[model samples]
Target: MKFTERLWQDIAPIYNSILKHGFVNELMAGSLPTFLFQYYIQQDALYLADFSRALNLLAARSIRTDDVLQFTQFAQNAILVERALHETYFSIYAIEPATQKMPACFAYTNYLLATTSLQSIAVGAAAVLPCFWIYRQVGKHIYQQALQENPYRTWIDTYAGEAFDVSVNQMLAITDRLAEQAGAAERQQMQDAFRISSQLEWYFWNDAYTQNQWQV
Candidate 1:
């Protein structure tokens, strides 16, 4: 099996939990409260801003010119395409600009930034892969099972659409190529990074569902 397939297997439990999460189920059923979805959109906007930066960091660190170009385009799409989706939601919901990153957003984005800046390019690619791969999976799951008249249909369709699939396939290919070139130790680190990010992906969704906030 390919390295990316093994990474997916390693996170099967976490992915299952994400699919079972109340936030996802409610969104699928069109029963999620507007306030919760608004909060999530706000936090997600913050996440994309930093996520693009992390991609740029990886782009800079990539040894292969093609990898560099791919990461750069990925960064551009994260900012332009995803942010456009957020903006549509913002206008529809009248969401004001978010002033702060919630705890989960802060932790997840910071982890990506730190890893991409400090780790090997292979490991950095691993760290960011979950965002692309897991979302594609969840998006497809939701699209398949979601209510036909769901309010979050746009969100679901955006992630599950062919354009999004193209980007995801690119990321998966890049990650597998990197893994093929990596030493055994580096591959282990890649797996470790992918696992931690996958865990964080669950926390991010649950955090929004619970409306978690800072104690201070």
Candidate 2:
């Protein structure tokens, strides 16, 4: 089996858990409180700033110019396309984001940046793939029950739509190609990064559902 396929099987339970996550259920039902969604989007905006940096770092480390350019464009999309959704949410909700990152948001982004810097470009890429890939899956799942008047419809549509699917497919291809050349140990490390980030994906929504606030 392909490494990415195996990695997904390993995290099957977590992926399933995400589909049942409260935030998602609430979102599809059109009952998620606006305040909680606001909190999630705000931290997401802060989170993407660092995410784009992680992508940029991988681009800088790329031995292949095409890889470099691809990563650079992915980095730009993180800010330009995805974060634009958050910016629109900010306007609709009329809430100013915290000047600081929320706890869960900080942990996930820092882990991605640090891992990518310390590990292979492949591992770095693996670390960040879940954010893109999982959200595409989540968006597809949630859109099934999305009401036309759903307050979060824009966010849902952004992820569930074709353009986002194209991005996810590109990232998956990149990971599989990296996996093709990786040794067993490095492959395991890449899977570890993927799994950890996947789990963090769940925790992010859970944290938002509970509206986790910074203690300080």
Candidate 3:
């Protein structure tokens, strides 16, 4: 089996948990409170800013020119398209986006930035892959099971579309190519990075689910 396939299988439990997360379910069922979504959108807008920078670090460290170009564009897309989507909701919700990161939010994005800054690009690339790969999977799954009149239909459709699938496949191909030339230790780092990011993926949503606030 391909490494992506094996990787997915290894993380199936986390993947399944994500699918069953209350935030996902309520969004699909059209039952999620608008206020919760508002908080999520606010936090996500902040998260994407950091995520885009991490992509830049990944692009900078990439050995291959094509990978560099791809990751740069990935960063651009994250900044442009996804943030535009958030803007639309920001207007609707009348939310003022904040720069302050939720604890879970900072932990995940900082992990990516620090890892890419300090480690092998192979491992850094692995760290960022879960966002692209898992979101597409979650999008497709929720699109299938979601309520026809789901309040978050546009979000579901944006993620589930063929365009998103193509991007996911492209990232997977990049990851596989990296893994091909990786040392065993590097490959293990890749897996470790992927796993932690996947776990954080769960917490990212849970933070939104709870609308968690600063403890101070």
Candidate 4:
């Protein structure tokens, strides 16, 4: 089996939990409270901003020119394409610009940034892969189940769309290629990074659903 396939297997339980999470189920039913959706989109915007930075860090560290170009384009899409979707939601919901990252967003993004900046390129790629892979999975799953008149239709379509699929495929290919060349120790680190990031994906959605805030 390919490394990406193993990564998926490792996180199968978490992905199942995500699919069954109340936020996702309510989203598909189009009955999610607007306030929860609003919180998600706002936190997501903050995430993409930092996500783009992590991609750029990988681009700078990438040894292969093609890998560099791919990471750069990925960063651009995080800023341009995904953020455009967030902006549309902001306008529709009249969500104010988020002033700070919520705890989950802060932790997740910092993990990506630290992994990409300080770790081997292979491990960094693993850290960021869950976001792309899991979002695509959830998006497609929701698209298949989403109500016809769902308020979050645009959000679902964006992640499930052909364009997003192309980028995700590229990332998966990059990760597999990196994994093939990595030493055993590095591959273990990659798996650990991938697992942690996958868990964080679950927390991010749950945090939005709970309207998580800094208690201090």
Candidate 5:
């Protein structure tokens, strides 16, 4: 079977949990979850922009072809996708994209770019994996709630649909493929980067909640 098919297989448990409880059920039913959702919407755009800029800077430097190509492609796609959704997210907060900046967001973004520029492509790819995986997990969780409520039908349906599955599956497939191609050193770098980025993601969302003055 294709890597994507296998990835979906591997992620089945987490995916199902997200579909069944996290997105839809846990999200809308809990005040904390709603605030968390709003926080992410208000903050992710700036972080994404930082991520994009980092990728572009890496592309400007000398790097090995294969890994760089894969990461670059992913990062570029991320920029375009983020931009596509920015307007909708921004409208929710009555905020414009030009009006936001967080130091941590910049630091994370710069770290990613610097990693891609100075380290192996495997390292860069690993750094980005947490973001993709968490997104899939969160979307699945939120969708479950939306479906349960039958409100926010578009958001619920979008998360519940094949498009989200396809995107998450694609990232996992890439990770699997890269893991096979990477050597021990590269793998270690990737692992460390993944852990760090995952933590950063958590903090990023936490900051959103705090900064937004959201109750709960």
Candidate 6:
């Protein structure tokens, strides 16, 4: 069987189920503290720098194409936007950025760089899909839930921000395009990467929740 077929086969169920669950409102809100704790407060800039360099290495050859160029632009923009959050967190906590050690965030970002560095674009798409799709779904769900609960207004407001939605949609559209153009084997590789990354995302969150046990 082709990689795409296998990849779709593996994730179709989980993807469908996630869409079905309609994103957990409470869970999404609850997750904000952990996200802040991990990415903004604890994560070191070196981690992002390393991950960004890894991506640059992977795209060195392939980034000549217009599509690839656009993707890289998106990535650069994303890093900028997310980094702003880190700055905000630093201001709020008066925490020196030097002491932060966001292992889980680094691990997740590293996984992306490592996979994309060695794998094809299809594989890179798979590695990245989870982050895009999960965030969109989570954001949408949280926004809907916020209509009633009114809890975590800041969290709801952040995810519901137009910029975040735009980025997620743009990334997903890119992934869809890549998947459509990919050959069977490439698709499978992409799918495999996606499944692993998806599960890894959940685990990363779990890791954030259980801070202090972080090793990598």
How accurate locally, in lDDT, is each candidate?
0.95, 0.90, 0.88, 0.96, 0.59, 0.60
lDDT of 5: 0.59
Could you tell me how far off, in angstroms, the CA of residue 124 lies in candidate 5 after the best superposition? 0.4
**lDDT computed for candidate 1:** 0.95
Candidate 6 off by > 4 Å? 1-41, 44-59, 98-103, 147-155, 212-216
Q: What lDDT tens digits, residue by residue, belong to model 1 across residues 56-120? A: 99999987899999999999999999988999999999999787988899999999999999999
What are the TM-scores, per candidate, against the unseen true structure?
0.99, 0.97, 0.97, 0.99, 0.68, 0.71
lDDT for each residue of candidate 4 in 1-216, tens digit (9 for 90 to 100): 999999999999999999999999999899999999999998999999999999999999987999999999999999999878988999999999897999999999999999999999999999999999999999999999888789999999999999999999999999999999999999999999999999999999999999999999
Pairwise TM-score winner, candidates 2 and 4: 4
Candidate 2 TM-score, true structure as reference? 0.97
What is the RMSD of candidate 3?
A: 1.0
Query: How would you encode candidate 2's per-residue C-alpha lDDT over 1-216 as one tens digit per residue?
Result: 877889889899999999998889999889999988988888888888899999999999999998999899999999999767877888888979777777789889999999989999989989999998899989998898788899999999999999989988889999999998999899999999999999999989988999887776
| TM-score: model 6 vs. ground truth | 0.71
Weakest ten-residue segment in model 2 by summed lDDT: 95-104
lDDT of 6: 0.60
Model 6 per-residue lDDT at 48: 53
Q: Which clashing pairs does model 3 show?
A: none
Per-residue lDDT of 1-216 in model 3, one digit per residue for the tens? 777777788789999999999999999888999998988888888888888999999898877899899999989988998987888888877888888999889899899889889989888888988989999999998999987788788789889988778888998998898899899888889999999999989989999999888899
Of 2 and 6, which scores higher on lDDT? 2
lDDT of 6 at 82: 56
The alpha-carbon RMSD values of the candidates against the true structure, listed in the order shown, are 0.7, 1.0, 1.0, 0.6, 5.5, 4.7
Ranking by lDDT: 4, 1, 2, 3, 6, 5
Q: For model 6, name the residue pairs that clash.
A: 3-184, 3-187, 3-188, 4-187, 4-188
Question: What range of 10 consecutive residues in model 3 has the weakest lDDT sum?
Answer: 1-10
True lDDT of residue 207, candidate 5: 64
Model 5, 1-216: lDDT tens digits are: 643344345445544544444333544554434455555555677677767665555455525575457456656766776665656645654654444555556567777877767776556666766667766667666665443544344444554567656765665766677668878777666767776776666556546555533244
Candidate numbers sorted by TM-score from highest down: 4, 1, 2, 3, 6, 5
Off by over 4 Å in 4: none
